[model samples]
Target: MDVWPSLREAAARVDDLVAALPAPGARSAAQRAELGTARDAARTLRVRYLDAHAEMLYERLTAGTQGLRLEELVEAAGAGYPSVVPTAAQLESDRGRRQADKEGHEIDQGIFLSAVLRSPSAGPHLLDTMLRPTPRALELLPEFTRTGVLRTRSVLLERRDGAAYLTLCRDDCLNAEDEAQVDDMETAVDLALLDPRVEVGVVRGGEMSHPRYRGRRVFSAGINLKCLEAGDITLTGFLLRRELGYIHKLVRGVLTDRPGSWHSRTVEKPWIAAVDTFAIGGGAQLLLVFDHVLAAADAYVSLPAAREGIVPGAANFRLGRHTGPRISRQVILHGRRIHAAEPDARLVLDEVVEPGAMDAAIAAAVERLRSPAVVANRRMLNTAEESQDEFRRYMSEFALQQALRLYGEDVIAKAGRFAGRSG
Candidate 1:
């Protein structure tokens, strides 16, 4: 039996069910039951569709059509039936399947790398790949270095005592990221890693310049909700630029030592996050990837993406590694706030110091950690903690779920509410 036709029929049924369901207010028992039934059926159909889609992609990959673009293939796969054939639900399902496939590919590549490293002849080729930028990374360099938008620098790179400090300087929005800031940040990270003079790296938020947060420091407020509310950033752009581009790049850069490749690297410089005031949403997510975190006593952290109706980038993968699964779930699902003084905060933060003493504490930490032995130990610890296979799997899952949440209806509604408030 042809599965594509059946998948299309299932998708149509899901669309019909969604149309029949009661509108967004409180629902009666019968309405709730009907909605639940529809959701269950849709979920099952979505899984089947995803599996078939994966099979089709595999066929294409094995049939000497590796030149075909992934997005184009996905689009071609869904080119049948009505406008609602590839609904939000189906798209999300497809994303998950694609992510899994990507993880598998990366794992195979990593196995190849390991084999090459072990070989007497191919080890130099692996190092060359690490030292140079791949074609895809080169394509993204324009986004990283293009300047002319904002007068002030969003990311400031400073060198002190053999350490490179990349400060988030967008105090106007409490260090909330815009496109320029994201680009600058990616550039700063790249420069820091490539600079041989830099032995260690520190990332911190600057003192707020806005009236609302005057004289105070903030790590970041995550994505600039004002931009989202203003429709300056569409759902597609948010997924591609912010989630996949900026946040993903920063996390991968810190965790993986290499300049290129999505797979985690065996050698990476240790990174420290010196968070002050508040680390909300994307800011808080950044802390998860850092090797160590030092927060001011008054600083508080939260993954407010739940409130914003979106997924916090990479937080789903790394939060549980810092905090336990329970706390991570609460923070992600319930918008739980963790203050520096709280015991649970210790999971993510290595130390909590007096508000005015954060800089000194960070300096001391950097002084102690900026050594060749420390770098080697860090790489060893990272390898022991999680393999490249595990990292690839987590990132793949994160990319899919984050993309779906960014483009989902709930986030759109939340953005509308934010726009209303700003207006």
Candidate 2:
């Protein structure tokens, strides 16, 4: 008369049956046929039970017919499943294959529709977030392990001036809960990129609002370099770690090592540039690697190695090479952030516009670079810059300096500053 235990057993059997279907070759003939029957029953249950069909079907299958055995289904599904899960290496290799075969896409049909219906006013932040990462955006990406999402978004629009623009937005997140949920918005973005509706490789940042990273956990500023390092093992860490290899491949894909490719040219891709509200420490380092820099006139750009009792890493190398060693040393040693009055003559931006004018400036620059000839000329100039061995030496020296600085008394002093801090 106690049906509860019987139902539980039946559910177990059903789960096994479904799980075993992936490797049907391992099943006995009778078990295979039984699985087919159970599957059919599941289909029927789907239509009949509607709301609780899955649970009902699972119970029915696990019940194991002594002859054909509802219990056998559960046993079969469980037995055929692998014990060891795929490793991060395996998953990454698989993910890369999938990504290379397709393109990153954005899922914005709903957002787009909402924006259209709502007639939302687009601000520069919104536009920047929505814009895709251009080719050669970053030379290196770090790798992390955790549940993650890789998303790409792109939008094409014609300016009123008759110029066509392609925006590639790329944003990724990891450690998301509920993998099966419809709201893994990155999946939608990936679908868009893979679809032939637009040029492949175009990407945009994925959904900015997901329950996991939304509301009470909005991105707060004051996340300085050390805090950034701590969070490397967090969501941002996973995103960076997972995509590091992909970033490398992308750079190699576009800038071949072979002669006469973009890598070998004296200039670089004309439209390649970086514009951001804040590029501090590593962020600033990465941006300086760009051929063109656009910063909000008020955007704080700093290499605060001295402030942190450490040496700047890549930023020191890149900026020092871009400017002379003396200027780079002064900036890094003094923790000199760029003030509003600085000139851009030292291999920085051609001009730094007022905060509101940045978007316009970037748009104008992109328009100019759309020309193939201009891009080619820029590549030649950049290639000339790249050929300087002194710059390469600088990066090497900077790396060494950073490693040494981490152990210095300065680092201890800096650590003292953060000892009692709370977010």
lDDT (10s digit) by residue, model 1, range 265-369: 522467889998889988898887677899999999999877898667668877888788999999999999999999988998999999878879999989888
Best by lDDT: 1
Candidate 2 lDDT tens digits, 125-178: 122122222222321111101112232232222122322222322112211111
Task: Name the lDDT value of residue 184 in candidate 2.
Answer: 26
Error of 2 at 371 (Å): 1.6
Q: Whose TM-score is greatest here?
A: 1
The local distance difference test score of each candidate is 0.60, 0.35
Cα TM-score per model: 0.65, 0.41
